[model samples]
Target: MKQFVFLIDTGNETSEHKIHATGMTDALKRVQDLKNHLNDNSNSDLKIKFKGIIYENAF
Candidate 1:
């Protein structure tokens, strides 16, 4: 598995999430799922921005 570090910018603040996945495709899917969940549950005015992704060494 590989580690993917996602940098999420919410306008007000930024958050980091580390995800373990088989590859880039899996990592992207996971990130999309998280964005969808956040969008569905958060206030309408809240905007989610994806700053960047860091592909880490395999573990």
Candidate 2:
């Protein structure tokens, strides 16, 4: 496993998610999970998007 940094662009704000996964697909799934959590917990009308994979194998 490796550390992957996913750049999540929420239209109004940007956040970084550092996840441990074996590949890009796994990292992407993590991002989606985060998005779901945010949507379920907030009413801020977030426009969530997967910006890009910023870094891989960070540590």
Q: Name the best candidate (by lDDT).
A: 1
* Alpha-carbon shift of residue 59 in model 2 (angstroms): 11
Total backbone collisions, model 2:
0
lDDT for residue 57 in candidate 2, whole number 0-100 = 46
Q: Following a full C-alpha superposition, what root-mean-square deviation does model 2 have from the true structure?
A: 3.4
What does each candidate score in C-alpha RMSD?
3.3, 3.4
Give model 1's TM-score versus the native structure: 0.70
lDDT of candidate 1 over 1-59, digit per residue (tens): 56777777666677888778877799889988988887787654444444445556625
lDDT of each: 0.71, 0.70
Clash counts per candidate, in order, are 0, 0
Considering only N, C-alpha and C atoms within 3 Å, which residue pairs clash in candidate 1?
A: none
Candidate 2 lDDT, tens digit per residue, 6-43?
A: 66665677787777777888877876798789889777
